[model samples]
Target: MKKLVKLIAILALVSLSQISVAGDPVEKKSEMKMDHAMGTMDESKMMEHLKIRQEEMLKMHDLSNKILAETDPNKKQALKDQQLELIKAEHIQMMSMHHPKMMKMDK
Candidate 1:
């Protein structure tokens, strides 16, 4: 019974200390709620970002294709996997431009 009581006391102290050190939870939530203000970004600015990214992705896809053209089957498969990842990143970036994720920062 004494050992159990000591363990409980230690756990309680650890939890309390962590809470004090972590600071405010409300500030964290507000940071997530805050969205990117796209009001300042004009159409041409958006187009420019998109255009540059599209060109880069195209170049990477071409490079990946060239890698897959090799006679080695293993190298071809690896190149294909890398190509998929580049495509996924491109899609994610495209989506983020319209609906950007909020920064996880102190409010």
Candidate 2:
């Protein structure tokens, strides 16, 4: 999960650097506007949700690792069940965050 976050940040930086290199004035202006709008939208709503999702995913990953390493069958089953519930909740949360109205507002 940390690696995934790092990769996304790296990609964002690379893309922004490329934008600065563009020579076309109109293209740069439009790109800047688009970037600003996206940043604003993310800061307002999506970024907070993403942070929560990232933390949840990290917890799920840790639970998975614990499940794999456990020797007792009963304990393992309990961990598996917990992980399944976490997954179901995560799915419902992601779906709600991505509703059409929210997405349309971002665009």
Candidate 3:
């Protein structure tokens, strides 16, 4: 009888622990709500960001073609330099736009 009681207590404790590991339903619901809100708020900004990325990709493709067609080493180097500068500027702009808080913290 004592062994049976101990077994039942252990089983109850294991089940309770599993339930705690499953997480709180109320907290999950609130997190879902917050995610939904953020998704809606950022939908337009996300579209704009995607469009900017596509444009940058197109520019890169054009620059690559120009580099491939150029016969002069000096001119090719100049084009490569321009591409590098453009990429750097774009990176800064992207960081400022998407992570303004982090950029501010850097200062």
Q: Which stretches of model 3 miss by more than 4 angstroms?
A: 1-37, 40-48, 105-107
Tens-place lDDT per residue, model 1, 1-107, is 65674465345333322111112233422223223564454566556544554455455646544664668888887876765555555444334433455322312
Q: Which has the greatest lDDT?
A: 3
lDDT of 3 at 44: 60
Best model number under TM-score? 3
RMSD of each: 21.2, 14.3, 23.5
Clashes of 1: 0
lDDT of 2 at 94: 36
Give the range where candidate 1 is weakest over 10 consecutive residues by summed lDDT: 15-24
lDDT of 3 by residue, 4-102 (tens): 744653453333221111122334222222244455535665565455445555565567668767899999999878766655655554465457799
Model 2 misplaced regions, further than 4 Å: 1-40, 96-107
lDDT of each: 0.45, 0.51, 0.52
Error of 1 at 79 (Å): 0.7
